[model samples]
Target: MQAQIEILASLQTVDREIREQTGRKQRLLEDLRVTERQIQAKKGEIDALSAAWSEREKLRVEKDRVFQDEGKKAMDKRMRMSRIKNAKELQALQREIELMRLGNGELEEELIKIMQEIDAIRAQIQTKESEMAAMQEEWQKKQDELQVEINGIDAAVSEASTRRQTIASQVTGDLISRYELIFSRRGGTAVVEVAGGICQGCYMNVPPQLWNEIIRNEKVHLCPSCQRILFVKPATE
Candidate 1:
């Protein structure tokens, strides 16, 4: 029982290392996920700006078309003036032409404003695209580095698990199962030492009978307070 307890203790040590390594791997993976989300968010920003720029470009095209058609119509009206002979009719036609000219002048100003706005939106799109590219590049490097670290952790965990299995084989199946249960329940401490009639696991007093049994090393004992397996170091020559 004494030697068996020693084997269980060694098994617990390796199991603890495996648990810690697995936890570290999970944290690294979560960090990678967070960075990926940031990259996706950056892409969304660039897409929205591009859509807005496209809409403005469409508006500019329509405004320029209206400006061209209005100029053509005003020119056609001016050609009709040469064909008019009556004084009042000629004067009315001239006034109509003047109104069309003023309307075209207003449209020309609007077209200028639209062009300027399109230029501004294009500039914004360019800036956002550049920023997105840089973010993606940096993320790529970080992702590669994280993946390498995760792989290394995986290899280490695999090796530790093999070692734990070997140590566990030295312990009885019933005891191993019981210890695993306590280990999971007690936050990784399944086996503990008994010293001065006290359970080291919970720092509680051990019953006299249980303390004597622990010292005898004839059977496995448990700490009542923390429910951890108890052992005592045997005296050496």
Candidate 2:
């Protein structure tokens, strides 16, 4: 029973080491994911800006084409003005020329607006592209640093796992099984020290009879409150 208790204590140490290393690994992994997400978001912004720039350029080209077509139609209408003979026909032609000129002026205004919008979109695209590049570089640097930290943690975890296995091998099968059962249900603390008449695992006072029994160290004991295997340690350093 004493040997079994010693083995349980060793297993507890192993479990604690494993838990600490696992927590660190999880934190590092989360940080890596955050960095990756930041990079992706910046890239998405750049892509959106690029698409907007392309669409604005297309609109500008179509507007220019429309203006040119309108100008050509106005010239053709003027050429036809000299061929009209009747007064009524000449007044109708003059009215048509005035309407065409007004339409051309409206189209020219629209073309200028489109050109301005295209220029603004292009400028925004340039700024976004530069920002994306900087963000990507920062992301890469973070990735490299994170990779190094992850690698170190991986090695530590491997070592801790190996040590756990080694310690587990020294314990009897039944005792190890019982410890694992308690650890799985009780947050990796399957063993507790009995000191000052208290169950350190639960921070509850132990019964005097049981406390005395534990102090003798004749057999392994379990805390009444938490049911963790208890051991007695020397009071002095």
Query: Best candidate, lDDT-wise?
Result: 1
Worst 10 residues of 1 by lDDT: 42-51
95-141: candidate 2 lDDT, tens digit per residue? 99899999989988888887888788778778877877887788788
Q: Which segments of model 1 are wrong by more than 4 Å?
A: 195-213, 234-237
lDDT of 1 by residue, 16-135 (tens): 998999999888889878878887887788788778878888988898899899899988989998998989999998999999999989999988887888788788878878887887
- Each candidate: what lDDT? 0.87, 0.83
State the lDDT at 1 in candidate 2.
64
lDDT of 1 at 207: 95
Q: Backbone clash tally for model 2?
A: 0
Model 2, runs deviating above 4 Å:
50-58, 82-91, 216-219, 235-237
Kindly give the number of clashing pairs for every candidate: 0, 0
Q: Give the TM-score of candidate 2.
A: 0.82
